[model samples]
Target: MSRYQQQSAAAAHVGGAKASTDGRRLRVGVIGLGIGRMHIEGWRQHPQVEVVAIADPDAERLAAVGDAFAITARHASAEAMLGTEALDVVSICTPNKFHRPLTLAAFAAGCHVLCEKPMALSAAEGREMLAAARQAGKRLMINFSYRFSAQSRALKAQVDAGVFGEFYFGRTVWHRRRGLPGFGGWFGTKALAGGGPLIDLGVHRLDLALWLMGYPKPTWVLGSTFDPIARELAAKSGKCFDVEDLAAALIRFDNGATLALEASWAANIGEAELMETRLLGTRAGLLQHNLDEGYRFDAHIFMEQNGAQFDLHLHPEAGEAPSAMHDFAEAILQERPHPASGEEGLVVMEILDAIYASARSGEPVRIAA
Candidate 1:
């Protein structure tokens, strides 16, 4: 068999590390030790997934995660891992710098890919990833973790049921009091992270809001960003932080809908953190927000009918929503569309790029068709 086809066939055995009863289970490989650990749990939740290999630039981290997961295949770099292991799927969980190259390599290796948020450092890179996935006829999904929240899933159901007639506007915000991650790490560097809080925190909210709005065609974006808090925080730690602490943008879609998005890693908000999304539609308005800055969320639907107003609430049962990882696995098995496909990620990237561009140019940036 061809090497690529052999890899697909042996996916069931995870390169003989473990035997698959069904023999069709997908062999999964994950890169990046940090978020890659989360990806491991995500894939392991499914019955038809076998985590065969993992890779990281740091050998200590590579061995640590591999040991923790009982995975024997470990490599110091993605190139080495891809070359050595026969994998059916690979998760790219590294920093923003490696997203594009790893995704392309995964495609070339005849493996489907699940990439972390923000897709890549730029819209252009996201486009390249999309094209590579398409050219290789491989599935590509982005892990927009927020969409898998029970609150978001329930609100989406309400919208899909026509409870919210026509989405007109939305405001999504995620702010943290002092949550600048890895001050001296790649996240604090503009070159590695692309931007800062907007790309990190705002991307989640933007994706959730845009998904609810049915992926509207954005026409233009006006944005502003600040690095005030990071500056003070970094000086105290004697480190340098070059990215923004806060970012806000107004994006106009061709369907006459507008969305206001704000994100910040270090803000003076009294709360430790806050995350919320409010959507306005012709029939009703919907709200989904976390309580007390915790992960769990509550959702409410507001409707006025026959001169009467009603507020509907949702109490999602535990595990009401399947995780993005689970859904991505199912898509591969069923040969169906992934929940958060690369195309969607690319569109979100375009909006984010416009946001940063607008912030730089101090004017609205038009999104080209």
Candidate 2:
């Protein structure tokens, strides 16, 4: 198997260390110690959760996490950890390709899953994972972290309240200037990451857009992808780069609303990082700009009934909401529905697939039924 595939396969076996805890804490096991560390930290904030185990193939990293968490019983494999620890939920933080398999394994092991997005490498894999979750009667949630952002929630409230009447057109963008990740790591490998900026950064905005639009079904998509930045930079730096550095798509929804999407890891744009979403409606328009600045959003409403034009600017209130991971834990414990479900993630995957297909064929691709 290829190195990326081997790494992904090996990840399945990374096990967790044991922690002595009261039965009141919800036992949890985390796979993929890299970003999984974030999950561990988030879970620690909740008194109801006990991160009983963590798994990763890298012995040094595993040992570091175990030591930091003050836990023993470190295993070298996720399967081993799942086999040994009777966890209530397992957080899967592996690469995009491993999401489905790990989630299925967790469900089969009788644990709910909080997986990082873009859920799976493809829509088909997402469907399979959803089915597995349904059959196992376990909660399956994608880590579409943006959904938990206060700005995003506020925008949703406005949209749902008819503040943005009959929303029609929207634009979402996640752009970076020369921000390639990990040089030749799995992130740059198409086989491992599925795609480049679209799946990684773009997926967040896509899900955000869909969620704001009430998870509208995309009917068709036209997209273009380019790897000019990565390929040229790799040639000069003597690095292995084989993924698109930029991707853009136009999506048409079943409700007749249209969305323009753009994502890039490397662009000549002056912005160090720019992430924003804008929605237009008959009654009003809403925009969230400069995501790095805590995703502050501004809402605009127009009134022109008597030939006198008036524009209203709204600065909505914000709050210190719970982290997405924390919310997932609450859903598991409270038996409430998670905001980012497996099915919602599937829609994002379907749009991604369509974008890829459209890019390859140089034509618009219709969403598959």
Candidate 3:
């Protein structure tokens, strides 16, 4: 058997340590210093959590992050850090390729994991990770950060209140006219990132839409990807770029609902960055979109009352919403379900797999049960 497979099988039998319950702070370790910095900040928000160690393959970046966060226990690899520290939680903020292995390793070490989005390169890998977590009796949460925003939470509250009844169609998109990330690095490499903006940026919007719509089961997908602009740019720079820059898809759900998903790292558009999710329902329609091409977003509800169209703008409550990492820490401390579960991440990965498949086959791909 392969090394990871062996680890996976072993993880099913090894029960990891649970969150501390003796009035002690939870020791946390974060891997991959790039996005791991944010994870550290989020964990610090919880009064019962302390980020004790960090890891990264790049020595320079690792050292810089360690110093900035005042985290003295740092390692050049996850294995070294996991071996040295008795952590209650491990955050896997690595590249797409390392998510599965790191998650399984963390599970084997008896630590709950909070993984970054897209879960892994494929849905199959996501399922394995889920199984490993179940076997270890560990909590596995996905860092679907966008879902923690005030705008998103407000919209979700209304959805739960039945303000938007029986959603039939939804459109979610994240577009960047000239915002290719790490153009010559892993983001542009298909093997490393799994896909371009579709996996990176689109994952957030897709999750937001699905979460608001109660996560309907996707039945089919027809997707297309293009990279003409990225190809030309890569040719000029002489870099290793093999992934699509833009992707669009139409998805059908078993509940007779449909979703239109679009994402692009580079495109001919007015906004430098644009993100929006609109859900059409029987009672009312809801919209959550970014403002001024920036991260701040606004939520709105549209409906007809007294035979007249009306738009109601939503105002978020006073305090700031918790980050996904904060929610993870809270859930573990409270012994409750986290905001974004592994199953939800798996669903997103499955849809992504079908999208890529449909893009390749030039035909609609049916999602397997």
Q: Highest lDDT among the candidates is held by which one?
A: 3
Residue range 276-319, candidate 3, lDDT tens digits: 99999999999999888876788999998889999999764524
Tell me the lDDT of candidate 3. Answer: 0.87
**lDDT agreement with native, every candidate:** 0.85, 0.80, 0.87
lDDT of 2 by residue, 253-333 (tens): 999999999999999997877888887888777777663423344444565556786776545556555777787766555
Per-residue C-alpha lDDT of model 1 across residues 232-335, encoded as one tens digit per residue: 87889887688899999999999899999999998888877798999999999999888766666888999998999999988666355666778887767765
Measured against the true structure, the TM-scores of the candidates, in listed sequence, are: 0.92, 0.87, 0.94
Ten-residue region with minimum lDDT total, candidate 2: 6-15
Top TM-score: which candidate number?
3
TM-score of 1: 0.92
The alpha-carbon lDDT assigned to residue 8 of candidate 3 equals: 8
Cα RMSD, each candidate: 6.9, 6.7, 6.0
Candidates arranged by lDDT, highest first: 3, 1, 2
Off by over 4 Å in 2: 1-24, 291-317
